[model samples]
Target chain A: GGIITQTPKFLIGQEGQKLTLKCQQNFNHDTMYWYRQDSGKGLRLIYYSITENDLQKGDLSEGYDASREKKSSFSLTVTSAQKNEMAVFLCASSMDNTGQLYFGEGSKLTVL
Target chain B: SQWGEENLQALSIQEGEDVTMNCSYKTYTTVVQWYRQKSGKGPALIILIRSNEREKRSGRLRATLDTSSQSSSLSITGTLATDTAVYFCATDSNTGYQNFYFGKGTSLTVIP
Candidate 1:
C-alpha cells in the first residue's frame, strides 16, 4: 500500500501573507491534484498535474499556484492570504486520470 | 459554478437506520465517484460507478447512477456511528484531461 503525506497539518497566516503547502506520495502515480474545501462549500479544485513539471488550473485557481517539481511531490502556494479565510487543502494522486485517487490527510489553513 | 454540487442536505439518523444522499452534476461525465470524509481528514473514495453501470454495491454501501438525470445517489444500510461523515460525489469528465470535479457534499450524523 502507498501513502500520501502532507506537511504542516495546520497553518495560520496574516492577511496578504504568502503560504505554501507541500505534499508527497509514494504511490508512483502519474496524476496529482490540489483541492480546497471550505465549510459548507464542498471541495473545489485548485490545480492538478498530470506529470512532473506539468500544471493545470481548475475553477478555483485564481489565488493559488501549484508545482509538480518531481514525480513524488506536489506543492501549492497561496499568493496572498485573506483575513477570515479558513479552509482545508487536500492533496491527491491517482495512477491515471481516470483511476481511483489516494489522498493525504490534508493541510488546514487559517488566515487572521 | 461547480459541476457536481450536492444538495446542501444534512441528516441525523439513529444507528440501524437506512439513509440515502443524492447529488447532481451540471455537465456530462463518464464516471461518478462517491467519497466519505471524516472530521479533519481528506475524502476517501467509497464507490466509483461508471456510465455503463447503473448500480454498484460494496458491503453495506450502495450507489446508483442515472445518466439521463445526470445524478447519483448513495445509500447506507444499518448505519453505524462510524458512518458519520460528510459524503461527496465526484465526476470524471474524460475531457482529454484529468478533470475530476467534486460536489460540496452532504453531512450525515449517525446518532448512537
Candidate 2:
C-alpha cells in the first residue's frame, strides 16, 4: 500500500510569520490537495493541483500559497500566521478529481 | 443537520447501539462520501454513494442518498468504542473544476 507522509507533525509560529508545510505521496496520484481543519469544523480546501505545477484555489485560499513541485510532492505556505490560530493541515491525493482520496496524518499548526 | 446551513453536530450513544448521522448539501453533486476522523488525524473515507445510487453498504456501515432532497445519511450498526470519532459528509461538485467539499461533521462518542 502507498502512504502519504507529512513533515513536521507539529508547527508553531508567531503572528505575521510565514510557515510552510510539506507533503509527499507515493500513491502516484494525479490530483493533490491541501485542506485546513479547525477545531469542531469541517475540512476546507485551501489549494489543489491536478498535475505538476498546476494550482487551483479553493474557498479558503486567501492567506495560503501552494506548490506542486512534482507529482509526488505538494507544499503549502501560510503567508501570514494569525495569533491564536490553531488548526490542522491535511494533505490528500486522489487518482483523479472524482475518486477516493488518500490522506496524510496531518500537520498541526499553533500560532502564538 | 445541514452542512451548508449550520455548524457541526454532536452525538453520543452506547457502544452496542445503532446510530445514524445526516447531512444536507445545497448544490448539485455527483457523489457523496462519508469520512471518519479520529482525534489528531486526517479524515478518511469510509463509505461513498454516487448520485445515481440510492444506497450503498460496506461491512457495518451503510449510506443512503436522496438526490431530490439533496441529503444523505450514514448508519453504523452495533458500533464499538473504536468507532468514536467525527463523521463528515463530503460532496463533489463540478464548477469549471471538480471540487470536493466537506460538511462540518457529526462528532460521535461511543461510550463503552
Output the number of the DockQ-best candidate.
1
List DockQ, one per candidate, in order.
0.75, 0.68
lDDT of 2 by residue, B1-112 (tens): 2232224889999989999998889887788889999987788899989999999999999999999999999999999999999999988766632478888899999999
The DockQ of predicted model 1 stands at 0.75
| Pairs with steric clashes in candidate 1 | A42-B104
At residue A46, candidate 2 shows an lDDT of: 92
Model 2: lDDT to the true structure? 0.88
Number of colliding residue pairs in model 2: 0
Off by over 4 Å in 1: none
| Residue B64 displacement in candidate 1 (angstroms) | 0.6
Ten contiguous residues minimizing lDDT sum, candidate 1 chain B: B92-101
Per-residue CA lDDT of model 1 for A35-73, tens digit only, reads 988889877889999999999998889988899999999
Please identify model 2 stretches exceeding 4 Å from their true place: B1-7
User: What clash pairs does model 2 have?
Assistant: none
